[model samples]
Target chain A: MKRERVTLRFSPDAYDKAITYHLVRDYGLVVNILRAEITPGQQGNLLLDLEGEPADITAALSYLSSEGIKVTPSERQIVIDKDSCVDCGACTAVCFSQALLIRAPEWDLAFDPDRCIACGLCLSACPVRAIHSKFSDPIEEAPPADEA
Target chain B: MATKTIAEINEKIRRGEAVVLTADQAAAMAKEQGVKAVAQQVDVVTTGTFGPMCSSGAFLNFGHSDPPIKMSRVHLNDVPAYAGIAAVDAYLGATELSDGRPEYGGAHVLEELLRGKAVRLRATAYGTDCYPRSQIESDIRLADINEAFLFNPRNAYQNYGAAVNSSSRTLRTYMGTLLPKFGNVNYSTSGCLSPLLNDPYLRTIGIGTKLFLGGAQGYVAWNGTQHNPSRPRNEHGIPVGGAATLSLIGDLKAMSPDFFRAAYFDGYGASLFLGVGIPIPVLDEDLARCVAVTDHDIQTTLFDYGVAERNRPSLGTYSYGELKSGQILLNGKKIRTAPLSSQKKALVIAKQLKGWIEQGDFLLSEAVAPLPQQATLHALNSKDEVK
Candidate 1:
């Protein structure tokens, strides 16, 4: 039987691979053990694709959540803002798993969540303040209005 | 101002509809499309900009007859709408036919005319700076019932040249350059650059021509705003100005078959081009200025921008040579690639590789292809291992 894969999606702004990198490095999760995919996006979000034993997937989720990696049932993806980003040309180095890439000198940075082993080493390396954690602090929902 | 549903608005238009939905009505419809609020109260929908509007006309021939089909303006109209946005004018172009019908001639005329053409529409309701949508809608509903409300290009062309900028000389020159052709045209000289970009309702109007001409570099910050500075200038190491941008207006008409083209002119304050369309994205104005450079020079620029790699996303297994070679074979077989080239197959070899790269299944290697000279990739993964 084919093992079912758990899918997750980060908020467009939360698609930072740095959080994934941290999960991989500190959590001992194998970046290549699962699938990471960038979905065809109108909003252009990066998705993480992973598959393994149920325990392993659970462990991956735990680690991802601890690192603030946002996961959804829909996709494992990150959204990149091309304008606010400055291409430091650095994220190309730490991704031994080959998940992060500098597309070209002129274009801003891009991350291949598929190749990313969820390693977070590149998180600190980015100088331009471009990269972000997939799971940022959850936004507080507005309190229910008083129904006098 | 309560926004109206698309059905209600369409119904009004259908039912000899003079009912102007309140701003709220329009905003609510816009909200369904992920827009928050209609920043401007104009019901007039403006379209996004066209890319490759520059240079496409320069090197390539769109195949128009020599002396390039003489275009003349038949009519122009400056219309006032209740939508709170500035009055818009439409220009129309009709071929001078011998037997009362146009001699369906060349490609460029149809192409360029359709690309930049805008027709003037008739609107009746007019009020001061503040007119509630409900009031406007009721007024329009009550006004004289003329089924002819849509703007025609001919009327737009006639009045567009007459719009007075701060100075008559500059405005006259603007008219002279554009008026000669008289093809369908849509341009706003009211200096309302900011609204064109941020207005949710206008932005949603998927089909319509809109252009913002003359403004400052600072305005580019707002989405969808395109400003062409009056001179060839640069900002933040990016060049802005000259006929570079003016030339692009034609280029966009030449390049894309989809969507009408829009142009913006902002005085020299910034150096960059910002455009949003069916395929929305901002391309640096400096790159546009590179139109002055040769193909080789442009290729060099593309290399700097990482065009070869970014343009072609792939994983480790595929190489440019193999893809090209595959094309040759497919060509011999008369096979077509789907979306990518023309093999017309699901999951081409290169796209599969790209899937792998994105999925973390493989490492991209230099074996794929030699990095073009002046190429650079700024990956965000620190552990990026180039295998």
Candidate 2:
């Protein structure tokens, strides 16, 4: 089994499409919506945690691409500027996922990207403005080259 | 009883024979060998704390321009500074916000200056006869300024309370974010390693005492504003809540960016994270006992920040040991606790101060005047009519 975190962006036209329904029914993938900001007529995005067989997950992503939904890897979504962070542990208070923590003995701040659900809570909790989101807005990727 | 004077300690330091220990090490040694034994062997106990201090600011004397302007209004990097002092002198407060930038403020400007970055300086004057210029604009770096010194009204709080929320909604405060229904507790103190906590009653730390400030030697100028010594104390004579702050001054030109930086809270405004260390000479067995205080002995009240009032409801008092353990039992619930102050940086600073004293590079100073012990705080009365 394979597990991957990804962001699925939907354009206004794709809002009516059943993206998660297709992933679970056709691709046999477990789709967990970590966060979502979808309105009926407006463009929105969903942060999802997908778990399934390697081939099934790949096929589900391909299906999403064909349906005009943009899929972005969640690896680079959250960035912590280590140089500016003082490791005061202020961000750990609001991080429910335990993604941000202060290591014991040394009291150094540690960030585990895998544990983060990208809830965007740590962005404001940081006192030095160190935590930031790279792709906060939905990026509209150019439509796949029309192949007749 | 083993007793020594600050002069004797300084002589030992000069001869490279003074025994110095960081507050944490001294506390452990005291636990092993007892306070009397440690008091006889140790000459100095160094303590440190790195935390956000909102009452910190810097005074800069910019050299006069070609045509001198009596700067009535001054802005540095778009952040307003108090320029009512002289022709080119201004005081930049840490909490002063930029015109539109909420995250950037005077603290950021000071940090950038320490990093050797140039800041834009713009000033306007009413055009005096002696100083004819009406307005001036220029770029100024730390090296270009005549003098830059830090004058903090309050720093190195002796003790502080932990904050928790009892209401249904989360509270965003200077104590960091407190979750609803006491989800988490937030505290800001260096515990046993804090300077004021080690000295407790201001026995060794007072006016004219030379100590480490932002990596530079600074002096305790006065009793800090809101220096309430009348706060209730535990059996060890330590305050149960926030008490006994210090007003400090130092040469900002000689400081390091590592020990000084700007901080912005989620909803709270800008503040400076200052690293301060104070050396407590083992002048007597009494002073030795104070420095030997450990996290297990130090206690503080946990107040509910959910109540939006000056006097919040106190939940209970807990030791720093329990707080540092990552979780504490509050009302039979295991609540996770977090610290706003950096214990790692505080330890590093304490070790650095110990190194300086052991190498005979830094000498202790006897306080010219001791801080008042009977000071009490009073709240402003809005209903009182002005005379």
Candidate 3:
């Protein structure tokens, strides 16, 4: 099984449609809605974590694009600029996922990309403005609906 | 067991026969063997604290150049350092903010030096008869300096208070970012592993005492600035609020970058994370019992940040043991509590200090004088009044 964090930009017309419901029924993907900002008849955003077989995840991404919804990989990550980062571990306090941690004996900041649920809590916890939101990662293949 | 002298402990250390234990180790030993038995055999208890100290800085001698400029002004990587001292000597204060940018400060400059990075050095002076160069803009690294020593005015706080927000709005405090509307609580201080907490009365941890400072050999230069030993205490002799601190001196060249980092609080400015370790000699059953005090016995009142006053009303007091359970009850709500201080680093320091003593390299010192217990701290006048 594979997991990916993706953000869906829903158009006013698509907002009224049961988008997540179809993904689960059609592709057999486990969709965990982390955050939802969209309302019916309004262009807005929806953040979700989708888990399923690699083939199913690829097909789910393809289906969303077919329904006129813009699909993009969130792939959110917490980046600590070493020069600015103080390793104060403020983020570790509110980090329920334990993705951001202080390595023992050295007390250096360590971020595990795999463990992050992209809650975006550490962005505010850092005192020095050291933590940055990064979308750059090895995003899994989510081909456009026409190709896959 | 009779009270042992510092001389006896040093002699044992010199002979590689000293019985030493880290604060965490000592706590466990006291529980298993009892404070009496442990005190009889142990020669020293190594304690440590890793926290953000704003009063930390270093004085550096950059060594004169071909045309020596009696540096009346100095800038390291665009961040200014106080240059009024001498030709090349300057003091970099931790809280000094960089030009315009509040986030980058003296701590960041020190970190750059620690990492052996070249800094943009700019200085100006009135041309003297002997030393005639007026201005200089050069790149300098820590390797080019003659001497660099960190003489921190304060470090190793005995104990600190826990912070939580009672108001509905979030508070960006000098303490780590407090979540909005009592969403979470944050606290600093190493709790049981803290240096002064283990010593309680400042019995053996004193001036000239050896310490593991920023992963290097250091010493207590003096009682730390704001050495308030008169804070009210509980039955266990632990200060309920802010208490004693220590001034430490160490070679900045030997300091580790890993332990020392430049920090910026959201509302408050830049400060350095100072790692300090002090070894306590188990002189008698009394001293041992002090070290044995667990987190359950060490309690402090959690203050609401909403008041924005020094006298923030206490939500209630909770023991370190209870706080460390990872959740604290606040206003009938079980709010999650997290420690800003790295207990993981504190434990590392304890183990390192123990290793130094067991190797017969570190020596414990007798206090020339205990930190003042009777000195009353002066409160600032809320309103100006005249007779």
True contacts kept of each: 0.00, 0.68, 0.41
Q: Candidate 3 on B276-342: residue-level lDDT in tens?
A: 8888888889999988878888988788887888689888888988777768876678877767787
TM-scores of all predicted structures: 0.20, 0.94, 0.85
Q: Which portions of model 2 miss their true places by more than 4 Å?
A: A11-16, A39-43, A65-73, A135-148, B384-387
Each candidate's DockQ? 0.01, 0.67, 0.36
Q: Write model 2 residue lDDT over B1-387, tens digit each, in one string.
A: 888988899999999999999999999999999999778999999999999999999999999887788999999999999998878899999989899876888999999999999999999999988999999999999999999999999999988999999999977788888889888999999999999989888888889999999999999999999999899999999999899999999999999998999988767788999999999998888988999999989999999999998889999999999998888998789998888999999999999999999999999998899999888888775777574
Give the clash count for each candidate.
99, 0, 1
Candidate that beats the other on TM-score, 2 or 3, i.e. the better one: 2
Regions of model 1 farther than 4 Å from truth? A1-52, A59-76, A79-134, A137-148, B1-49, B52-387
Residues B68-111, model 1: lDDT tens digits: 22111111122111222232221222121112212221122223
Q: Which candidate is the best by lDDT?
A: 2
lDDT of 3 at B97: 86
Better of 1 and 3 by TM-score: 3
Candidate 3 similarity to native, TM-score:
0.85
Poorest 10 consecutive residues by lDDT, candidate 1 chain B: B295-304
User: Is candidate 1 or 3 superior in DockQ?
Assistant: 3
